[model samples]
Target: MDTYQTMDVAVVGGGPAGLSAAVTLARSLRSVAVVDAGEPRNAPAEGAHNVLGQDGIAPRDLLAAGRREAQEYGALFHDDRAVTARRHDGGFELVLAGGTVVHARRLLLATGLVDELPDVPGVRELWGSSVLHCAYCHGWEVRGRRIGVLGTSPMSVHQAMMFRQLSEHVTLFVHTMPDPDDDAWERLAGLGVEVVDGLVRMLRTDRGVLRTVVLADGHEFPVDAVTVTPRFVARSDLFEQLGGTLTAYPMGAFVATGPMGRTDLPGVWAAGNTSDLAAMVAAAEGAGVAAATAVNADLVAEDADTAMRARAERYAVA
Candidate 1:
């Protein structure tokens, strides 16, 4: 590995959160570096919605623009995965997949979460197109169409209810999820969502357009769009080197963090999907800005203390 170069902050992941943090830190005159492996969770999606002022912007375009903005401010970006990290000389050093090492005084773990999709056919192929997860993200576009909510877990009930608001014809396919309780049944009935029994054999599509959902019993329900609840898992394995931990929720697990994305470990912070699994692109960007602000304040305090100590040593020498 080459000799480690020092930086003020290392932002990992290169998604909306990472780019946002790099831009903010670089604008503040801090030496910032971003490490990303180019695998974004939303890469399959044609466009990212629900991000104000950037609604419907292609995910790649958004990241490219953010990268250019940060580069204009002298922020360095490494197109490699940070495979390992450890505490070093009162800071942290990260080893990338490309055998380069980087040391930084503070770290921003913005590596977002991964969505584990259901083990069903055609779901992966049509994902981010006709098959979706979030109603707020792609509901409006498919409104008034035949929408199907595949049952992967109990959470599918909520997904059906949310999508029902956007479409009149909504079906809840109990493919593999446990049977709904009385309350869930009541809610589904109230929302006018039809419940289908039996495991889903596969999704039927024609010419790249979703057509219907086929059950194991050969029952077919016509559908124009579908939604599934995928398990959300944050990319926090590298946090082990810093003695950081994650917290588990009903939906998934994420790194634990306090206000301003401060983690339990000193000199380390987390933001975006690393901590908030429910955060969208816009929310993740806001969290990155907040964390950057806090990090900058901390560096300012450390700088003042160093300056004072240097003055004291000079006076003693005189």
Candidate 2:
């Protein structure tokens, strides 16, 4: 705990959420530190979209810009992960992946989620390049190109429909699904999508350009781009380790936060993807600002409470 002395606030993760939170807190004159593992989920994406003022920006570039903004505003950036968080006396103790310990009066967990992609051939190679997940991010670029959406969730058909809006050609490959509902079938029919019954054996390619899909039934569906709707697992185990409860969902999950991002933890708060999975870049920036404000307010209250108690004690002594 004494390794870094004391901090006003400590933010975990380095993606949109943590970066935004650190920037907001630092701008507010708080001595803030951001602990990042540098493993962003969208690292493989070519660029991100639907974010105000930063639409179509590359994920890594955006993160770098965020780091600069936060650092310039007095946020200390560290290339480490907060592997554990435990409650301390009126503060928090954070242990990084490298065994570095930092103590802070308040904590902000902006650790984002991780997506588990399927082990299809050439999938990882094309990730963040030609193979994308979010339609709002990459659909426009791949429009009219042959697109394939692998079934990974109940919302997968819905994602395919979104892609269909961007392209005339879409195929919803029925892979790794126990059974798709009638509504899914209906959506596919309405969107005029090709449905492949056989499992996806592998993806054929041409020097990083996805060419075709080899199926189980000795068939192939050639595609120029592939969209996947992966299941997101919230990387909030550090918070969970401290008995922090969360509301989990299929596509995403979030720690329950109040108006200003205060969770049930006394000296701990949350912002960004850790608490609001739907938050984009600009929105997360605003969220980080709000959460910092909330944390500051809590500190103010504690200060006031201490002062009032001391004044009362002095009068009692008199």
Candidate 3:
């Protein structure tokens, strides 16, 4: 039942986006707090790519560095999950799993999305390792190697094309995805990509390392890495609790926001995967900064109005 002082801003989910926002708000001398559940979306990935000045850094290490930087700027962090949220007294209140309550004038949800991998066997076990998505994230490591794209959705064809740019040895396993159109088949053939038509039974692994893709028809193809198109579902429980509806997309669902991370919910904002499903680590960080600036500006306007009202009252009293 411990309650914290009402902060200027409360950021939920302490990943790249939340931490960046915390740093920015703290630098602006705004009282800010970050609540994290400690389960980062990229925790399974060995390294994050495309992050400038710290490319290929491990996900945990990057987050640790972000936490340190935010702390250095006087941002308070709670390593607990925000279990419940409700609007309160012209602001918002969040109840943590540990029983602490956080009160803030503004709420920012940087809770990243969850990657729901294909139901195929071995995919979850090897995720973030031999099983991967996003050509920009782990494509370089598998470059010039035997890369297999698991067909789970129409986007699987697009994935094959993306990986073809990185590796000459690319195979598209048409497991469950719809048959490619004539133009898609022609493009794949033009790129010399092998197309295998069969239901993928499982991904064969040896000593926890992926070795091959096994088909239901008893055929197996050796591969160095497999790509999948996971459905990206954003973490939006708290947002929903606050009466925010998730915007559905063909690939997944997310909380919709404006360019500056301002959500439709009043006094509530979102950044990172919560709003932008395609955002990478660097892009999430940028979104967080943008949301922080917007929140700070909103607060500045509110403060000015309050001051003006106070001055008017003072003159009347005099």
Best by lDDT: 3
Stretches of candidate 2 off by over 4 Å are 314-318
* Model 3 per-residue lDDT tens digits across residues 1-318: 889999999999899999999999999999999999999888988889999999999999999999999999999999999999999999999999999999999999999999999999999999999999999999999999999999999999999999999999999999999888999999999999999998999999999989999999989999999999999999999999999899999899999999999999999999999999999999999999999999999999999999999999999999
Candidate 2 local Cα displacement, residue 314, angstroms: 4.3
Candidate 1, residues 69-167: lDDT per residue as tens digits?
999998998999999999999888999988999999999999999898998899999999999999878999999999999998889999999999999
Candidate 1 TM-score, C-alpha based: 0.97
Weakest 10 consecutive residues of candidate 2 by summed lDDT: 276-285
* Residue 96 lDDT in candidate 2: 86
Local distance difference test scores for all models: 0.91, 0.81, 0.96
Name the candidate that leads on TM-score: 3
Instruction: Give all TM-scores, in the order shown.
Output: 0.97, 0.91, 0.99
180-263, model 2: which lDDT tens digit per residue? 788878878987998888788888887767899888786988899877766666687888998987687766667888878899
Clashing pairs for predicted structure model 3, backbone only: none
Error of 2 at 7 (Å): 1.0
- Model 2 clash pairs are 44-128, 45-128, 46-128
Which of 1 and 3 is ahead in lDDT?
A: 3
Clash tally for model 2: 3
